[model samples]
Target: MTLQAGTDTALAATDHGAASSNDYRTGTAARLAGLPVETLRVWERRYNISETARSARGQRLYSDAQVRRLSLIKQLVDEGHAVGSLARLEDEQLRTLLPAATPAAPAPARPVKVALIGDALVRRLAGGGRELFALDIVGACASLEAAGRLRTSGAEVLLIELAELSDAALAPIAALRAQLGAAAVVLYRFGASATLARLRADGCIVAHGPADLSQLVLLCESARPGAPQFADAASIALAPPRFDDASLAALASMPSDLICECPRHLAELLMMLNSFERYSGECANRTPADAVVHRDLGVAAGQARMLLEAALERLARAEGLALPVADGAA
Candidate 1:
């Protein structure tokens, strides 16, 4: 697909070659001729004076050829030749009449900002494509969060990296899902185990591997049908409901901040749930009311604790992480 200006495509196009600063003059003869820059533009528009060159930053610059052309046009205007008359001039006549002016070399293209992220894996995926937004390792999560926030604020998908998700970063994922809603898959890279599992849980079918992504880029470019869409596993077609609405609400409302602030607690919780699931096949869904009371939620815990823990488990299940021990998992 043809990339739009101000998009990553435009940025990449401008960065292809470097140009020297002295190649073109900015506001040179326009200042010397006591003419506003707009006047020069008017002559180009009205009289077809000269072809303009653009700078890396997208500024319009006048080449010496253009300056000489402008000078000729200005003199003609001073001598009372209306622009309408100038347009009808023969190319040979114009060339003969206008003095030779050395053309300035065009400026270098601008650098692209695709905002890529990940290990060698992400760069390989890019495959020499310009204007990638790059980030690596933990930075991938940070980029995802930033992209998620920007997408929520109506920003277009300029950069995306999906190699950074961990079992620990579910809340941010949830937030991104909630914001992107239907359009989320257009810019996302579904290449990790956690990402794949989450997509599966959501009932979304995402293509696997880097080759899949390269194919996707080609498909988009070709305007072909069958572009991949991530399935929402939460839908009825996927794993049916393990927890009801009230249970999910409770989980979302819990103090999940502890996941970020207290990594030690998170580690202990993950370990406990892993062991519990291994032995009992019970998924952990909630935080117990008292850390001291390790009750089998399905058969024992207080009703209040059961409800709370169930919610947390639902959130975890959606993200493909091990569920916490709660009434539902047990």
Candidate 2:
């Protein structure tokens, strides 16, 4: 077997094989399906989420149908559905099982100031899309270049629609946003992954487009900043699992000289916190709109983990129990 670039790429040659535009290799499928490659492989081996077609060399390939199924499964999983329960579901069955769409958020105390761009989008909103969010429309334009008159709007948010995106167009977009002295919510139907990731990293709000009216409203609301302290995700390097499941079980069950089983209780708490922290991190990657919320959860979990680990260490020492290698997180 040959290996290069990364494990997934090495498994698929550039020859394209019998793959059509709708067929995707492991990495693309994982990204589109919002799953890690390894996790997808495991699901294939265990749940066989659905039958997948492999390339000539035996490398797995996911058809467009399979990718869609995985995306649905991912959404359901995030909503608390167990993977095992969903794995056996057919695509249409999964769709029917999905809950009703997320309701629009309640309007804020004071409507946010926003400017609209794009004639069709503006017209659509004019017809009623603007009602989805608590927003004050200060200006309207049909294109980015035509947005010059908007400089006087004193808008806090700029909602622009892009039929397509190009890297060269980014600089002008950035400069225009700077001139308006406002944050932006960019809606696009298509763009290069790297370009989109770059835009996101620079604090610009982005969403798939042409978004439905409610989605547009959500994007506009996202431009509004949250509390100052939580503006960015807190930086905390969480250590790997401190103890395996078996180790934890053993620690919890072993007879202790202590008056109460405080250590056992603490161990349980630590396990819960650790699981939640990792889940938050996964959600951050899978859900673009709620990335901030997940990041916040991950940080809070890390803090809790460190404190609990310290308590666990002290109690373990008091009982003269051998502990795992120090993670130094406490």
- Writing each residue's lDDT as its tens digit, candidate 2 over 147-253 gives 65454345678787888877876886788788887888888888998778767766788788888866766677778655134435556565665665456666777
Best by lDDT: 2
lDDT of 1 by residue, 107-195 (tens): 22212112222233333542433212111011122244344423222211122335434544455545555554421232333445655
Separate clash counts for every candidate: 34, 0
Against the true structure, candidate 1 reaches a TM-score of: 0.25
Residue 161 displacement (Å), model 2: 1.3
TM-score for each predicted model, relative to the true structure: 0.25, 0.43
